[model samples]
Target: MEERVILGTERDFEAFAAAFSRRLHAGDVVALSGPLGSGKTAFVRAVVRCLHGADQSYSPTFTFWHRYEGTPAIDHIDLFRIDDPRESAELGLEEALDGSSIVLVEWWRNAPELVAERRYEIEIEGSGNGPRVVSVRRVT
Candidate 1:
């Protein structure tokens, strides 16, 4: 079954992320697609916090990706700069995705081909008024 949520504020986004975290596990793949300032990073931070049991998650926008190891390491990747999935492979994404860790990707459109197979796509849309409409599409 598919689920949906409306994040009316930053705290709401964090709550949503935490709820999503409960459903995730090692080897899970989440593809985040949306425009800039759409709360992708915020969502990732929340998930990382749930994983790390802290509130110290940072964006990997410029650094490409970051890995956190604990109970289950999280591989957070940002493909905003990458042009294609092949290029992402060059960054070792193909090898990293062995279904052994949770892979949360931002700017997923940059490497759409990388996620052509089974994956979860989170589409974030601006409401213009307030609250972000996050639509989660599951492809298996």
Candidate 2:
């Protein structure tokens, strides 16, 4: 199933994220796909804000992964810098993804093998400005 939304403002985007967070829980993996300058990190931050309320540890471009402490917890991962899928093992990615926290992966196309087989795919179109077309789909 899929839900597509056109968010005209940042507030709309955040509100959408907040509502979207309601449908998630522990062991849920979210794959965020978008080009550079897209609101991939913004979506992550908004979701984190909704889920944990005050702890939004969106991944820095250089970092491979960062975890935010919360009830269900959140694993913010950026595979953008990963040169090889083998690096996932070195990063203990599989360990963190022990079906415990809510995993959010950015630039997931860089290493699809590292993500869970069943997951949500969020695709954001339009970048560096107002109004974004967002599509959320479940792959299972």
Best by lDDT: 2
Q: Mind giving the per-residue lDDT tens digits that candidate 2 earns over 2-116?
A: 9899999888988998899889989999999988877888888888899888745544433677788788878888888877877766776775589999989999987888888
Stretches > 4 Å off in candidate 1: 55-62, 127-129
TM per candidate comes to: 0.86, 0.91
* lDDT, candidate 1, 27-134, per-residue tens: 888999888888888888888888788855543533887876666778888889997557866786664477777888999888877664778888888744479988
Q: Tell me the lDDT of model 1 at 5.
A: 75
lDDT of residue 106 for candidate 1: 92
Q: Count the clashes in each prediction.
A: 0, 0
Q: What is the TM-score of candidate 2?
A: 0.91
The candidate 1 region of ten consecutive residues with least summed lDDT is 55-64
